[model samples]
Target chain A: MNKQLVNIKNVTIGYQSKKVLDSVNMQVNKTDFIGVIGPNGGGKTTLIKSILGLIPIWEGSIDVNIRKSKIGYLPQFNPFDKAFPISVEEVILSGLSGKKHLFKRVNKTDKEHTEVLMKQAGIIHLRSKAIGQLSGGQIQRTLLCRALISKPELLILDEPSTFVDSQFEGELFEWLAELNKQIAIIMVSHDIGTISSHVKTIACVNGHLHYHKSNKITAEQLAHYECPIQIITHGEVPHQVLATHKH
Target chain B: MDFFKGIFEYTFINHALIASLFSSVICGILGSYIVSKRMVFISGGITHASFGGIGMAFYLGLPPFVGAAVFAVLSAFGIEWISKKGNVRNDSSIGILWSLGMAIGIIFIYITPGFTPNLMSYLFGSILTVSTGELVFMGILALVIALFFILFYHPILFVSFDENFAKAQKAPVRLINYSLMLLIALGIVINIRVAGIILVMSMLTLPQNTANLFSNNFKQIILYSILISFAGTMAGLAGSFWLGIPSGASIIFTLTLIFFMGKVLKILIERLKRKQKQFLPVK
Candidate 1:
C-alpha cells in the first residue's frame, strides 16, 4: 500500500469555462480527520467533487492509493425527491456496488455486512424503512452506512451537518470518530468551532487552500483566516458553543 | 360462460390477449421509471423515431421490428449521450430528434412509388393480426427486464434516486443508464405491434402514474402498475371485442376509465381513514 492515502498535487478543478479550485495540493495520511470549511459556492463542494472524480481533473492530478472504487463519499444534498422509492438498506448496499457482480446474487455475508454497517451508523432499525421515509438525521445515518459499507480506506463527506440537528450532528461526529482507528476521513463543514476540535487537520477551501493542523486554530486566527467565521461568531460566546467544541 | 369459452377457443384471440398482457407487464414496470425520470418526453421522441425505423424497413424490405429496434436503440443511446454531455437541455434535444426522425420517416414513406397500405396499423396498431413470434418476443423481453431488476437492484435504485451519491460509490452509472435505455427499447419494440405509436405512450405512462399515487415504495407501485396495466389491457381488449371498436382506442379508454375509478376509490379510502382518525381516541 502507498504511504500516502491521497496525494492531490497542483490540481485545478472546474466546470465548463468556470474555474473553481486552483492549484490545490493536499496529502492525506493515515488516520487523518480533515475538516474543510468555507462559504457556499467557494469550491468546498467542488473540491470534494473533484476528489470524487465527479468533474474532470483539468490541470493536475488527484491520485488515491487504491482504486477509485475503494473510496466512500457523502454529498451535501441528495438530488432526489421523496418520490424516489428505495429502502435504506438497498441504498447503503450500493456502496459495495463496485465490489459485487452485477448479475450475481448477493449472499448471506453481504446481508450480514450491511446489517453491521447499519448498526455502526446507528440506523439498524431503519434498514427495512424506505429512505424517503427517513428524517434528515436518519437519512444522514443511512448515508453514513452507505459510506462505511464498503470498508472504504477514505471517507469523504461534504457539509454533513447542514440538514441534521445539533445533537445528531454531535452524535454523528462521535460515531464517525470511532472510525478514526481504521479510515482517513475528509469532512467539509462550516461548523468551524465545533468540528475543528475533533479533526486533526483543517482545510480552508475558498477558491484556494489554507491547510493547517487542527489544534492550531484560534478565534484570533479565524478572524483573519479565510473561512466564514464572522457569520459563525454571533455576539457573546455561549457556553454550549464552547462546550460543544471542547467536549 | 359459453360466450367466454367460445372466444377462448380461438388460438388467435388467446395469442393476442396473452401477448398484450405480456407487453402491459413490461410497460408497467419500465414505465414507472419513464414517469419518475420525467423521460415521458424521451419516450415520446422514441415514438416518432419508430416511424423512421418503420419507413426504412419498408424500403429495405426487411423485418421492421428489427429495424425499429435498431433505430429506437440508437436514438436511445443518442439521447443518453446528449443528456450526459449537457450540450443542451433535454427538451431541445428530444424535440429536434423527434421532428427530424418523423420528417425522414414521412419522406421515406412518400417516396416508396406505390400506394401505401398498412401504414395506419403501424401508426396505430391492429391487434387483429399479431403473430405468435411477436408474442414470444415480448414475453422474452419482459422476462429479461424482470430479471435485470431482480439483480443489480441496488445500483439502479441508487442511480435513479441520486446520481451524485451513486457516482460517489463508483457505481457503473453509465452502464446502468445504458441498461435502462436498452430496457426501454425492449419495452417499446415488444409493444410496437399490439400498441400503436399513437397510443403506446399513454399505455406506457397512465397506469403507473395513477398507481404512483397509491403506493409508497417502488416494489408496491411496480406490482400495482403491472396489475393495473393488465386490468386496463384486458378490459380494453374485452371492450373492443364487445363493441366492435378500435383496440387502440379501447385500450386507452380503459386506462382513462381506470384512472377515474382509481381516483374515486382513493378518495373514498382517504375519507374513511379521516373519519376513523377523527372518531378515534388520542393515543
Candidate 2:
C-alpha cells in the first residue's frame, strides 16, 4: 500500500491579492501525526484550507493519493449556528454526505455506523439532543465523530483543542494518538506544549512552513525557525512571562 | 357551525378556506427553511423587492403577480450572487435591494395613469377575495414545495446547518442553494395574494418560530409549523368574519398570539420538569 497520502508542493495561497502563505511545502504519509503550530493569521489555516480544496492556491500543486471524501475534516468550533435544529445523530450522518448521497435517504447501515462512531466518541447518549444543548467538549466530540464517520484515510482537524476543557483536551489527544495508528493525521493547534507531547512531528507555520523531523522543539529552535509564538509550560508557578523578542 | 355553513353557502368563503390551506402548506414548508437557515432578512428583502415587479406589471397592464415573481426571483439571485462575490457586505446588499425594489414599485405606481390600483389588498392581503386561478397556482406551488422538501431533505438540512462542511462533502451546495432561492421567490409571489405583501412575512415566520419552541428537529418543525399555521389561519379567518376585521391583519395577529402561547407553554413545561427532577431521589 502506498503510504504517502498527500504531497503539497510549493503552494502559495491568499485571499484577494493578499498572500497569506508563500511557497509552503509539506508531505503527509500514512500513520504520520503532524502538529501544526502557528500564530494567528500565519497561514496555518490557509495551508489546510488549500489542502481541503476549500480555497484555491495561487501557485503550486496538492496531489492527494486518496479521494477527496477519504479525507475527513473537523473545522473550528463556534462558527456554526448552535440553535440550528439538527440532532447530534443528524450532524454525524451528514459526514456521509457527498455527490452520491445528495438525493438518497440515509440508510440503516449508515445510521448504525453513526451510532457506533457516537459510541466510540462517548456521545451516543446525546444523539437525540440538539446541537445547542451540548457543552463545548461534547460538541467537539460530536464533530470528531462526524470527521471519523467517513472512515477516512487522512483526518484533518482545525484547532480541535480550542473551546474544549482540559480533561476533554487530554482525552482528545489520547483519541488522536490512537487514531494515528490507522490513518494519517494533520491537526492545527495553538497549544504547542500539549501538542509536542502527542504529535510525532512538528510544523511551525508563519508566512512559510518549517517542518521539524521530531516533536521535541526547543524555544531556541523555534526562534531559529522564526516562529514567534510563545512556548507555554505548566508548573507550580502561577505564570512565567518570557522576555520580549526583538524584531 | 356558521363558518361551516358560510363555507358551503358562499363561493368566496369556500375560496378563502382553500386559499388558507394552500397558504399554510406553502408557508409552513418554506418558513421552516427560512427560520432555520436564518434567511428571514434576505427573504424579507426579496418580499419587498417583488413589489417593484407588481408595480411594473400594473404600469405595463400585465398581471401583478407575474411582475412580483420576476422581481422576487431577480432580487433573490441578486442578493445571493452579490454576497457570494464578497465585494459588498450581505446585509448592506440586502438593504439596497429592499429599498430599491420598494422605491421602484412606488414610482411606477405613482406614474401609472388611470384609476389608482387598490394598494390596501396587495399590502395587507384579501384572502376572502382570492380567485380560482390564484388558488390553482398556489395548489401547484404547495405540491412542488412539498415534493422538493421530501426528495431533498438531507441535502437541504445539511446545507442549511453548515454550508462549508456541506461543500467539503461535495453535496451540490450551489445547485441546492440556487434551487431553494428560486423556490423561495416563487413561494413568496404566489402567497402574496393570500396575506398580501405587508403581512406575508409574518405568515412565513410566526408559525415556524412557534413550532421551533416545541421541537428542535427540522422535520418535526416543518410538520408542526404546517399544523400550527393551518390552525392559526382558520382561527384568524373566523375572527376576521366575526369581528369584521381585515383578513390579513387578523391572520397575522392570530399567528403572533399562537407564538406567544407556545413560548409561555414551553417555559411552563421546563419549570415543571425542573421541579419534578428536584423531587427525584439523590443518587
Q: What is the TM-score of chain A in candidate 2?
A: 0.90
Q: State residue B93's C-alpha deviation in candidate 2, in Å.
A: 1.2
Clashing pairs in 2: none
lDDT of 2 by residue, B32-145 (tens): 999998999999999999999989999999999899999999999999999997699999999999999999999999999986566778888999888899999999999999
Candidate 2: misplaced stretches above 4 Å? A232-247, B281-283
Q: Which ten residues in a row have the lowest lDDT in candidate 1 chain B?
A: B1-10
User: What does DockQ give for each predicted structure?
Assistant: 0.52, 0.71
Residue-pair clashes per prediction, in order, are 0, 0
lDDT of each candidate versus the true structure:
0.79, 0.89
Q: Relative to the unseen true structure, what is the C-alpha lDDT of residue B202 in candidate 1, on a scale of 0 to 100?
A: 89
